[model samples]
Target: MNFGFLKIAAAIPEIEVADCRHNTAEMEKLLREACQRGVSVIAFPELSVTGYTCGDLFGQPVLLAEAEKTFGELMERTADCPAVAVAGLPVAVDGRLYNAAAVFCRGKLLGIVPKTYLPNYNEYYEVRWFASGDELKTDTVTLCGQTVPVSSKLLFRSGEVCLGIELCEDLWVPVPPSSLQAVHGANVLVNLSASNEMVGKHDYLRDLVRQQSARTVSAYLYASAGCGESTTDVVFAGNGLIAENGVLLEEAERFVPGSRLVCCDIDIERLAALRRKTNTFAYAGPSPAFRSVAFDLPAYGRSYPLLRHYNPTPFVPSDDDGKHRRCEEIFDIQCTGLARRIRHTGARTAVIGISGGLDSTLALLVAVRTFDLLGLPRKRILGVTMPGFGTTDRTYDNAMGLMRALGVEIRETDIRAACLQHFADIGLEADDRSVTYENAQARERTQILMDLANRSGGMVVGTGDLSELALGWATYNGDHMSMYGVNCSIPKTLVRHLVGWIAATHADEATRPWLLDIIDTPISPELLPADERGDIAQRTEDLVGPYELHDFFLYHFMRFGVPPDKLFFIARHAFGERYAPETIKKWLVVFLRRFFAQQFKRSAMPDGPKVGSVSLSPRGDWRMPSDASAALWIAQAEAIRTDEP
Candidate 1:
């Protein structure tokens, strides 16, 4: 396995009823093909050695003896193969017949897992032929001249991948055997099925596989019988699927003419990480002991193709409808959260600083929605425009126009003179234009907003978003601190999208123009003086790499705890030709250093409802050391940098 990914396949080979020799030969061919393609583990349909529709032939001594001989040949022929193969057949154990999947790896029989649940309903009568595993009197059984462990609690292990087996109807029951296997330590579940084709069954079966994999936090490989089976009474569609954590990685098209195989790489590390995070998934004490059969296989190399598609923008949905709906729901969450804060604090006015930037624009919109939800007059919402030294005509005009359009009580609090005076008082030259100068302006504007809110019996609504908080872009005790932050959990990339969405769908015509203009403007804090033409001089992205890259880094780093090397690999693949490896490596280094160095800023962040699964709320989702070291993470990224941008 490479980076916790195990290459697995679901194989469906053509078979004939009661023809054990032909069925076994077909399975052997598929096994060789799958193994050649680097499949570490492969699964075949239930009763594949002897067709599932064998009827009373299953009880005939001639059919049983032939199946035993064919199965032995299959095991011997595949003994030297590196891949682990699971093929289903009927095994006679101490006078009782059991439907079992015999796992083979490295020239030896690993174990046999029997079907737990048998269906006895319409168009099915498994109980008439085979006995469920629950009736087993002993844990060990003699099959094909080899004594092997046989039970429902058999877990096969090859290196890091733990394998679990379940039969067809076992998954259709209320509680699948795979569920307990997962909780007991199975990270990969395989199902051998012979489900008959019917109307609308594929959709339901697909959902079952997806949901079971997700609920168990394991990778599921399902292989079912195909069209070559006796179609006298029913047709087998040969549905094959490979799913991981509710996502279908790969699946075979139904009703294919020949034998089929679907393969994909399953991220076992991701599953283990999620299980570790979810408290309820912790294994309960004293479960049935698994008889593990250890086998050896070389680790997968980097050349193995990753069949999974990693979304470039994990935060933003690709579809327009999903994006619009997301914006609406996030807007409601912000408004409802702020409204509750206002009602609980008994504040009369909603105070916010509108800078004509994406973060501030989103905050102001939420403030307006909150007042409207509370049935308060629009004038009661105070929108403050605190123009600093770097303020430009375009942003200032847009800010003033938005205020006028919204009809909120707008106040102009220019901090140019006040900041200069404070800079001199602190013995710092305004011409220096360093962090001191920039922070002086930010602190001055924050002071104006806070004092005004106090005087008006209102609260200072913060505009700093999750992206800024992640990089510590906001000045400490200045834009970083607030009474309550409405945009705290939203990333800068999403902040822009949310603003544009509101302009297009929600904002009135008069206010829409200003909102669009704000979205078009460059993202900046206006901390420095403008250029000769009076345009923005200090773009945030120019200083700290693109927000798009930073947001991508933040999501994978925080949400999945992906290591630096693996994250770099995924970024190179996701960005494709858009960004070179060196560029991603550079920003990845910066993101890690900033994320660790800026934990002090996030340690005291204000209350904000988490709008997404990934959040940096110190009191809720994330809690990190203020002095955590970024040396190791940075060194790893720097090693991969070779001037290839």
Candidate 2:
């Protein structure tokens, strides 16, 4: 029952203090607008009906009665649409007052989730007005002429997208019930918060939302109490955010006063697929306790455009200042990871094979950065260039230029003679430039670096990237082997941008120009011989698709666990004109075939830092069976393509 798409809306509706009628009207307006926008699930802030700051009026009999009357009318108003909405109101059950959120879908009251933690600290006395949900004795309750299930353990269902709800403080508790909800079956978490405004509070709130989404590997929708609420003692900032699998895609700045709704389609298929991939995540034994609440959401046709933000450089920050800050931070993660390894092992230096390619360039930069960080002289960092069969003048010049500019210890070793000797040593022909020839050169280069590291009393620094590992482009036990790979977790597309970022932000006027030229050079492993102009002859993209397309497919497919059909659906939308459908189809097949065939390389990969969510490190993020079949994926991809007329 995995639905292809989920339309979610984080609604910030207009409100008035203690004005239940005005609140109901505003809620209805937003609900209708959301329904028209094809939002299947809409969420409003906590205590939205009677206003969160009603104070002692929560116990007022007149106010309670009016709130119920307005809610009944609001339920009738939203009865026609398929979109289910959660509205906050003070509900009294068996003479006990509770700060609760009521859910309505398709004319029926689905369930009610009450606040579990009552605030009792300074400036906040929620204990005076509301009761915790743990105080509830039963699940069945009568609301607006029908019996609705009322409990904190409610999972409102719409096919494979199981949703769990919790009040604001409920999520903030040490042992949040939402944790159990996720362990059981809920894949989507909803939080209705009426948190008051305070300095340094938003940061905590943002982190809380991100961690919850990541912990569950689920989509999280947070609708905080926004504008129009009473600010008698505390103020509310209309903050709304929508996050999926830990990444914050959209967030509205607090204190903004408008009817704001951040709407995006959650890739339910992706979440479900990830759960399948992480087979051990089923810590909770299979149970039939989950109830499916049915609702018929509009299709919006097969292709619904994605409104979520797309990071062209997922590894590189979009903001200029932030990108520099991140470059500095990541430089630390790489150098720190390596420095600790070096210190623990008592290695005196770090040796890297610099090729002036993006991956090796980044590795060399990390080594220099690490030594600088450790107060070790640059000369302690050894850069060896073992040029072989496909040596290009551009790369050779760039490599020498960078080593000279950085003042690192440089060693020049020509691998042509050494590899040819090895070929002869192994009784192989040196003239043949096949996988053996290419890999022999790579292994020889690595051997040189490794011996150099040992001779220098240091460890070899690796430079193979995540994308290279995914495609198995690295020579197994050759370039793929390293003591600690600084670039292992970074992808190809991202590696290019990081080098560019360093050039723009850190490199000097002279050092920067050569770095830019190095980035502009074609991405080649340089296994094949050079052309007439002494340029690269073995371009990586010729065998694999463009790194950008593969990266896009990788994020949705591996990170979110989206299916091939939906993935192709998204690729069509994102890279429509840039790449023709036929071309995308061809590369997509290449990606699947290569990805499945090459997981063995990833299975035995060296130690590397994980920079992003989707990593292929067998010990870390991805742990797939090396022989897992790509037949299903390839078949689905084939179906997406219509044969030429």
Candidate 3:
């Protein structure tokens, strides 16, 4: 279901230069098809009606009349279609001719936005034929027996969607009209271009579009002239792009044989939420000249299918190359931060607790890299493995093996004896296996790490990741408190990837196997006793819910401030096949409760580098009162009916 999503498309139709009738027919066919596919808005390339390569022919009054007539006919033919369509054509107002984009719905012209910038240099001479609309003396133009608003300041609004149009060179200008339009409340920016293909231009254009979308925090739709355009001087590859807030959702194949429509759904609600979250987005009030033109579109409810892809693991990159690059960058950030801290404090050694789990393993790897970066001996980074009741042989053996392979000083301290003694002194039964029992082991391990660091004038590196921090899964004064946390902003889902990346790219043959084994080991605090088979008995997920789900909740909840219901809506779509809706709702409730209850932990979190957009560090990106209530959020989440599609 398309919950708060608007489906939009960019159409590249076969066109004959100056043959307005044929162009109109092709555009109509595509428009109808897009409407049938439930596209709420569709855009065509610049000057598509008469073809962009008409050159000086754009000056001919007969050709201009035909283009106008064909545009009217195209609208009339697609009157029954339920989509807002933007078509490009030449408009002559009084004695001046201007390149324009016409917005039409239900056979009616809503508005026309003229091209602001006329590119007069390089391989093109658009100034030779068309005057910049910026010079036009009038705000309205008469066409097809109707007066339509023709200005760069016009915005088309339909329900929750507000779109602003720009033609060709307008996007290339230093300050595109879209910038002001977005500030004036345009959530979607459409660009129509007849740009020619050249070496390295496509990538540049894509980057420009994506960056503009990001800067404005809106969806940017771009449709360029295609194969049918004149190749007398240059070639048009028919590039079409749809991007939302820096991400390119869909791109049409360049140089395809026939007509093509690139379609994707834009999350209008997400953009609005982001705009509300960032004060700078709307710092400048709406422009006085800008006008909003209203239009109508059929409501797309939950029954409509969502076309965009939502990464189940939002914290981790989806592709292998991206994952590797991200891991490398994160590793560098961690090392740089730790190295700076070490130099600043003049610490001689780096001490970390190795659990043979993802978070601890990642922390150890970062410490090793940090020591290497600072030109310190690897032996100076002490890897301490504190095994307790729940320490399985597999994890214990892997921890020892990894520490030895990495050339780090290894120290094993069985905390069972110390924890039992503490329980006896505290008047608690050793067999209780309650929070006290688990927390006793955790505090003992932290005390040992802190003492060892003190002995060598080293600092304690934290192993708790973002997931643990979000869910308050760490023991407050135990695994939670550290001198410095390298994985403070790294999520559990990403920790696995980072460790796996090390295994594949950075680790030597001797260390790769142990890293791989650690990556596969189930995450646990190892405070409880092991089962008969020596496997981990207290699986973290079994108690706290899956890290993947928790990480997803943390990202949307903290990063975008998405409320519980909407979070549930998107999460169901993201992990629908992998988990049941009831299960999602259950964990979402847990996440909200724990997230609010755990703010105290995050409020006092150790110093850590911010690697991504979402961070729980009190001194950084996120700041919240530890006493905030989750009652309202939990209520909204509880209202979600899993029976609904």
Output the number of the lDDT-best candidate. Answer: 3
Please state every model's RMSD to the true fold in angstroms.
Answer: 2.3, 4.1, 1.8
Candidate that beats the other on lDDT, 1 or 2, i.e. the better one: 1
Residue 563, model 3: lDDT of 84
lDDT for every model? 0.88, 0.82, 0.89
TM-score of each: 0.94, 0.85, 0.97
Which structure among the candidates has the greatest TM-score? 3
Ranking by TM-score: 3, 1, 2
- Tens-place lDDT digits, model 1, residues 392-454: 999999999999999999999889889878888999964787899989888888898899999
Candidate 1 residue runs with Cα over 4 Å from true position: 283-286, 319-325, 641-645
For model 2, residues 1-645, the per-residue Cα lDDT tens digits are: 113667798899879988999989988888998878878788899988888888888889999989989999998877887788888888888778888888887677877878888878877789998888779887767777777877776787766777888888877878676677787778878889888878998999899888888778788889988889887788888878888877786787777887778788777777777777778766855543544455555556544456655553455567888777877777778878888887888889888998989999999988887788788899988989878889898899999999889899899999888877888989897568678988988898888988888888989899999888878888988999999999988888878888888898778786787789889999998878999888898888987879988877777777767667666767766664687878878888888899999999889888878766678888878889999999999999888853421
Query: By the TM-score metric, which is better: model 1 or model 3?
Result: 3
Error of 3 at 279 (Å): 2.5
